[model samples]
Target chain A: MFRHVVLFTWTEETTDEQKATLAAELAKLPGAIPEIRAFTFGPDAGVNPGNQEFAIVADFDNVEDFLVYRDHPVHQAAIAEHIKPIAASRAAAQFVFQA
Target chain B: MFRHVVLFTWTEETTDEQKATLAAELAKLPGAIPEIRAFTFGPDAGVNPGNQEFAIVADFDNVEDFLVYRDHPVHQAAIAEHIKPIAASRAAAQFVFQA
Candidate 1:
């Protein structure tokens, strides 16, 4: 499986309502796009002081599938409409997992 | 369960051998610390041009258990010995997972 991990640091001005909306929109991606095999995302629990404000861990069969999700209209809409405006910084990584 | 996600960017000087050592040591955490219910770490597969170089997604029963693994001598040793030196920057997040 290929894992797509993204970490987000919200801008100071971002509100809880905005975050909730982003989460809700993100939750809809699996149903909206068939390529997304697994998806989990939420606000950071703040156990580590250095932690970002939000995270997403999504799985796909391969890079092609991941790109399908990435370029899907729903996913792009979420990024442009919800994520980019409120996010201060975004860091991401992808890796292949065995077992 | 609580998910602990950490992303790392290696300094330009970091070598593949050093990264392999870090991954090998990280793979041992589940056995060395029973509180670590799940642990996965590896170099980024580089499908995304903007992605960081590495990531770790781990799970624990709760914050207390997560801390046990965090403060474990073996984990600390790995960070101090293998991680800090080569890591240029680190970003992390934790969240509760329903499943």
Candidate 2:
């Protein structure tokens, strides 16, 4: 299996209510994206020293499936409609398991 | 790189202070493991929903390195000393990235 994990930082101006709204919007993408096997997204509690704003873990069948999800129009729309408004910075890593 | 990602849920009674202490303990395992390249851990804000207690991402050179970290005395000691005292349930997944 292959996966892509994303960590996002929201602007300082972002409010809890807005974050909740965006989180709810993002929660809708899993069903819309065909290649995703599993999708998990949640807020980052600063309780940990290296805490950030949010984190995401999504899985796919393989690299191709991952790539499809990475660039899928549905995902792009979701990003444009929901994420772009509040997210400040983001980092992502892709991993594919090999035997 | 390969990684064994562990997701842990502390008992509901687990307090923030104890969780912080445990976080510091687990956070120290990376250096002692020798083979570990990167380690990141934080609390799940749960603001996005599907919330959990904590999530960790640790990277190693390969599967063997991951295994070494998993079973090493230093890691075991840390787990027993820090994690066992508070963690309620745990789930993990290992990934080996392919080129």
Candidate 3:
């Protein structure tokens, strides 16, 4: 399986309502992309001692499926219409695994 | 690289000092495992609409290396001595990547 894991930190200045909207947009993608078997996102609990916050974990069946998910039209649309609008900063780790 | 990513959530009743100690314990494993190229951990922002918390993102050269890290004495010792004592709940997603 291939996994695309991203750590997203939205600015603290963001309102709770906005966070809700962002989550909604993320949810829309699973139905929009066939390669995405599982997509999960959540808030940062401020418990760890490091530079991180929200995380998004998306799983694919294989490398091709992952790359497809990465380049899917729905993904591009989501980035252009939703995610990029409010994200303060983001970092990602793409893990390519054979299982 | 093989990545073993885990999300750990400690009880809210847990104290800050104990959390600090847990982070220190996790940090030690990187030095102990030579195959490990990168390791990162942090708190859950609680901004996402999901069931996740603290996250551990560890990268290894290959699946064998990750399995080694998983079985290493230092890792086993940390879980036995530190993590198991304080964690309230935890979930993990292991990603095996070719690149």
Fraction of the true interface contacts (Cα pairs closer than 8 Å across chains) found in each model: 0.77, 0.00, 0.00
Worst 10 residues of 3 chain B by lDDT: B44-53
Tell me which of candidates 2 and 3 scores higher on DockQ.
3
CAPRI-style grade of the A/B interface in model 2: incorrect
List A-chain TM-scores for all predictions. 0.97, 0.87, 0.84
lDDT of 3 by residue, A9-94 (tens): 66777778877877788878889898897676666544334535566777788767877887888788877776677678665555
What TM-score would candidate 1 get against the native?
A: 0.96
For model 3, the local distance difference test gives 0.69
The model with the greatest TM-score is 1
lDDT of 2: 0.69
Sliding window of 10 residues with minimal summed lDDT for model 1 chain B:
B38-47
**What is candidate 2's lDDT per residue for B1-99, written digit by digit as tens?**
564555667887888888888878876786677898877666653333344467677777877777788789988888887788888866555544422
Tens-digit per-residue lDDT, B1-99, candidate 1: 888899999999999899888888888888899998877777899777988999998889898998898899999999999999998999999888776
lDDT of 1 by residue, A1-99 (tens): 888899999999999899999999998999999998888898998767878999999889988999999899999999999999999999999888764
Local accuracy of candidate 3 as per-residue lDDT tens digits, B1-99: 555667666777778887788778888787878888877665544433453456677777766787788789999988887778778866554544444
Error of 2 at B93 (Å): 0.4
Candidate 1 chain A TM-score vs. reference chain A: 0.97
lDDT of 2 by residue, A13-92 (tens): 88888888877877777788878887766665333344456767777887778778878887888788778888887655
Comparing 1 and 2 by DockQ, which wins? 1
